[model samples]
Target: MNKLTLLLFWLMPICLYCQEDYDFDALLDSTSVLSEQGAYEQCFQILGDLRQYLRENPDKEKLFFLNIHEAYDYTRFGYYSKAECLFKESIQLAKELGDKWNEAYAWYGLGYVTQDKVLSNSSLPPSEEGKRAFFEAIELLKAEGDSAFLVDAYDAQGYAFFLEGKFSEAIEYGEMALELCLKLNDCESEPNILSNLSEYYLAIDDFSTGKKHLQASLKWIKEHPGEIADEIAYNVYRNQADILIHEGKIAEGEQLAMKVLEYAMEHKDPYLLRETNKMLIDYAAARGDYEKAFQLQQTFMSQLDSLHEMQLVLSHDRNQTLLNIGLRDKEYQLLGAKLYSQRVITWSAVGLIVLLLGLLSTVFILNRQSKQFNAKLKKEVERQTKELRISNEALERFAYVASHDLRTPLRNVISFIGLIQRRLKNHNDADLNSFIQYAKDYANHMNRLLNDILDYSKMGERRLVATPTGIDLNQIMEKVFPMVKDDFREKQGILEVGLLPTVYGDETSLIRLFQNLLENAITYNDKETPLVAVQLHSVANGHAVFCVSDNGIGIDHAYHEKVFEMFTRLHNMEQYPGTGLGLAICKRIVNDMGGEIWMDSSEGAGTSVFFTLPLIEVEHEQQSQENGAKAAMAVA
Candidate 1:
């Protein structure tokens, strides 16, 4: 048995332990059901009772995470500092007990309360400290041979990276998390990973990729469709609505958003209700229905104000920042008096007067400055920052458009030159033969450059002439595999094919994504087994995940971000034998097609590149794919 089970066994009476502690188990189940049914206060009461009972004769080490969960309940009710202190105590207890999983959980709990997971906090250094806790958790799980928990740690690290705005590395660790979870058939881990992947894609403006994950999430919902909790389905609709709005289909999006509000009301989940109302404000505004938006915004503000008023009383001691500022001068002067006892009376009177005057002065100055000088300073900074952001966005737009527009004539010039070279290569003259080779070589070189730019442009200027259709993406890979069969044969590398599912996507982009990733795998090998694997499947969100993995001369982590940029290559042209834009084109097309392109590699062990495509799983596409597959099978 693991430590958790053993600890539970020790906690219960022998008779009760043998019978499985049914009351405790029932309490947990009841709490889950109540929370899912949107009875937060009832669930909160149950949790409190359980924690209180457990704490009365607490097994300090075993109860460490119990308190952590107790703190989670507190945080859900807006008691953030109490939650933070409880989590910190749990972390210390977990460390002393050598329980890394609980330690990691504690760090995650604190982070969640801080809005470090939900909001941008550039003021804080990237929370590498939390990452270290997770790393420790993974190492412990690995030692225990618990791959599932190890996967959770990997995900935790990825979340930390995401919080820090390190998208590429975030994907890398996230990919590792998925790899481990997939191996273990860890069904519970799927929705969480898919949610993160959706967030990542949306950040990069890869709408399809984001939709893909949400799509997979729908299937996961289908897996236990009846047992599905209200919150799960509600989140699915809400996230889909958010994506649809971003994709500029606001009417459809608003309908979906309304569904979320309706669900929240039916369940009476104040938290979900608050979130939905907040979302409705944006959705209503987008629909150019300002009246509804304003109303929703007012409701949201009222909710916050009420909560703030309650918190002011229930959470007085929770403001550590305020307390620290209050206590510092008093503590300093007290220490000074203690060190200089001979002058205590003189120092005491002087300190008292100075402290009173200083307090009044600070209060007055702070109130005055905050109202005027601070507002002006804040406005100026915000204006400058807004201007910079606009300038940056304009530059990115110009680059994308210019690259796209230049590709057409450039493609014609290169194609004509190719024809010229083909004609000249047939000449019989000996001196002309040498000349033909030179012309052919230079033409091909120049053609590669223009082709790279054109392909990259095609990716950036993505306007799907046709929407995605479902394909057995793995079968598509089989077709691509044959084209590169000769290269594999020449290199004597082993290719591994994992279970692949049918995916919906633009065939052209899918083909290019596969081709480039596979090419990278094949070309950059030390030629051992030179193993390459083509893995594909459905993920929780409406996405088809595909990966091309290789055991090769892997890339360093620093270059991972650089690798996606156009013409970014670790090896020189002569050494690598091609334009670096191949991977960049792959990255662009994958991103443009509403997907992500990311790499996972160290210096030598292996590299696995993962990308997701929009799944064809909306209302009507299922029938279309089935008919297409049946007809193709008949032809075969």
Candidate 2:
């Protein structure tokens, strides 16, 4: 999987919102129906109803399911805080019920939301929380002998990694998710994973594959039109159009976008309508079709007016719900008070009863105080979330600028190098070998720049798949080491491998990851005889830990994290024959695999790098040694 796949998967339909005034089944049916009819007002109205109903009746099994649906609703309406709250609440419920399937679903909900947040901000929030939630859910399912949702857990884990700009890891988990989906013949899951994988391809401008998966999704959606509503179809077409436009199919993309917008207007989906207008304006303007762009803007202004009108309707509906809740509460309180007064007077056993009531009231007041305190905590979380989003946006913009502007020079260098190579062919001097190598180095540098852009651009915009395979890191290294043996020998480096174990992730990404890490160790060495050691050890809960330690110029503590940033090199390119992208790509790969990357060194001592891959990504067939027994019988 790649960035394009991740991006598309980031918008995968890991969501379902419950509907209003209706029963659970009714809400589901109505929401589906309204959406099919393109009646977004009615569709969302049903969602609001379901939200209120679930809030009022948390005891219902339907309400438990509503937890997922409510999150979707809140998210669709741009209430990220509320959406996050709903996911947390549902996860809490799943934890209490010890329900593995639902728990995994909840974790996916978190991943889906986090993925969106990342796209909007240009980076994912810290993923530890998401990974922990997924692993915990996987544990529950495993204990209960329910591996049905194992793929979902892995999928979420992969997504958690992907958001942190871990494309390699994202691909690993995403593949797992895809494999599981295929095994289960889960059409719904298939498209999602495929879409996510497509995002990774897009990240590398592998648009052909991106378009392939997106088209696959569209095809499946058409075949099983019942699975998704018109809203989803609307989104599918709009997204496809964007890709087509970006990939140079301007006319087709424009037609698709316009058609979707037309459909939205037909169905009264004002939000989509508004967004389509903006896209049209930009699309037309970029094509120098100023008249068309101006016309589209005017059309959009009309839609805006329509949207305002629809908003009033929605507001009225919301106010009505609040009024109903208040009225019901007030009525209940009055009736209870009357009953209490009568009981006190009639029973005349009042003194003791009244004393008890007073005690109860006092306790209740304290509880309310605690609830208020909790509310304050929620507010704080919201504030932090907002701040993080703002910071992420800044980072994303900077990354975009850095990628384009930085690549511009590297591209020129590449072009110039080609020119030089062509010119030098006519004059084969004694330094021909060196010149050829220089050209090769320049091409490699350009490739590094492109990879760096993919790394930076990947943060917060891709979905991950986690598919466990029978991987032997030992064997993998055996193969990889031979390829790099000459390099190590040339650098006079003593490379060693520690006890290796099999781990799960995307094969290509992992190979690239290790290859890059090894290259990094060899490329910038202060040691006369550079020493590189690679090891993989099994960790508790089925994780395989990988470490690559090197006897090289140690990095400062302050620059440890910065070193992993794309194009961020402490030393000059002249001093070190590098594009300053190796470490950054390394960090991204580790992160995408649901792992962390950090350094341990004293500026002069060698640097040790360690990363962990959790057991949740493993298949039941080849569980880690310690976890094998636990999974064997359960799988059996």
Candidate 3:
């Protein structure tokens, strides 16, 4: 009986090992199927379960497959960083296991993820790392005689080249992929390769060759309907429409393009909608339907704007997801540390039973480790905070550049509207003229809004570069008065000055600050004879406070704070023709100069704006004068 028991115990582990292996294989297969079917949630659940199982069982081979499957799923979900990390982990495991095939697969996955990462983050330069990874993958796959994956690798390389605008190189690799796919008798990827080839050829203006490839791709899809996705087939058809239009088959192309547009609308695909709308616009222009063309252009621009807004939202979500992932990683690290501590405590308990000295040593080690972990965590938090600040600054710069670029198109639109108005001047159609005038007005308003946005974005950048110097408020007021002198004179406004003092700040910023305040005082006033007063409020703590009070229309207490916000307006543009950015800009300038600004006013009462600026010390002023004199004497 004892001998039988020993034998059964030995057999039991082998049986359990076989059963575990079978279960792992089944889960992996299910995950692959789920991924293929686009059931990513279920796929991820299986992957997560597999990951946990592998963690306990410690199977590197199984872990490698798990990482590969999960990585691809993550890539599909646009989590490029997570995918890249998993691919890298897979590569390490493959290397340890001496599995060249899987290693090449991992490298290919890394390259693919990197390509997407670079595309999504346009600020990043083209990724040579991705290219290098593809090359490594190709070489490895070639050595292993894996033609199936090699085709994908070649296709990816071609796509990368296409993205970089290297058309010829793209064609070269694309042909290689097509040839390999043909030899392998794989019709599955053939249509995709042909479609890509068509695009490549079209890029180089080889219309005839491009059309041939496009036709071939369409034929393949038509013959094997289920092989290609409906979206892909529609895209292929859209490309055909583009070619047809380019070939001057306007009527036929318009018909097909309209169908594709319908499909795009039904699916609500922004990319497809934009492309189809763009093609339709061209079609309208070609047919000499200027009115239709203009309307289509408007639609295109609106769609483009919507797409941009969506992209921004997606970008925000992506950043939030990445932050969450980072936090989760940190949490996992903490959990691991806790687990290690628990193990250490359990060991220490054993040691305590054996020797109290061992337990004491363990306690000391734990204390030191806990301090080190805390210090590391603190450093990490600081680093992340700094990175967040940099990211915010970058976003500000992006906003500035985007708003600036938008002005060019807006200017063009306004110019076109002006041309239209001039051309229609002779027609004298009242309704048409009124519509044109409305368009012109709206365009002008948009222009003003964009200009304000640009100015607002520039404030932070100027603050970073501006050097503070002793500035004479009296001189600043003199310079500012002229810019708004016409308005004051036109309104018969009286500007009173009460002996302004010199303060330390950027001269230009100070000039703008007062100009904005003075302009606001004059513009917002409902009084027939507007009276604006600049007074020295106080001087203390090395800073001087100044006030600009207006005897015009005053703001309500509820809107006192709101008035300082960008784009905030108490009245319509018709009543007050000014961008609401003036006060906001003033606030930013004051804050940048290490001061504060506030308003004291009530509805229908005169308003008072108070602001502060640093005061130049007497010693510094005298020293500056002496230095200036010395320079003048040396120059003479």
Q: By lDDT, who's the top model here?
A: 3
lDDT of 1 by residue, 21-44 (tens): 445655555555554444554455
* Cα-based TM-score, every candidate: 0.36, 0.38, 0.60
On TM-score, the leading prediction is: 3
Candidate 2 lDDT score relative to the true structure: 0.63
Off by over 4 Å in 2: 1-106, 109-174, 195-200, 242-252, 264-320, 323-327, 333-636
lDDT of each: 0.62, 0.63, 0.77
Query: By summed lDDT, which 10 consecutive residues of candidate 3 come out lowest?
Result: 627-636
Candidate 1 stretches with Cα past 4 Å from truth are: 1-60, 63-73, 98-132, 160-170, 226-232, 246-249, 262-636
Q: For residues 464-538, could you state the per-residue lDDT of candidate 3 as single tens digits?
A: 898888876666666676687788888877777666666888987888888889889988888988888777789
Clashes of 2: 31
lDDT of 3: 0.77
- Superposed by TM-score, candidate 2 places the C-alpha of residue 610 at a distance from the truth, in angstroms, of 76
TM-score for predicted model 3 compared with the true structure: 0.60
Residues 1-636 of candidate 2: C-alpha lDDT, one tens digit per residue: 345334322322122112233336655555554444444444554555455445546664565576676577555544455577788888788768866677767766765676565544423353555446666766666676654567666666676676567888877887777777777775465655666666655555677877887888788887785787566567667768878888788888888887897898776676568656776688789889776775676668657645544553454454344344334433433343344344444444345465868655655565565556556545654665565455445545555665667676767767777777778777757566465655567556656655566565554344234454556565556556656677777876777665556676656566667887888788767788887877654476567677788888888888877777645668765788676667776777677777777778768787888777654343333433324232222222
Model 3 regions lying over 4 Å from their true place: 1-98, 114-121, 132-136, 164-176, 182-187, 201-231, 243-278, 335-343, 346-351, 402-446, 462-636
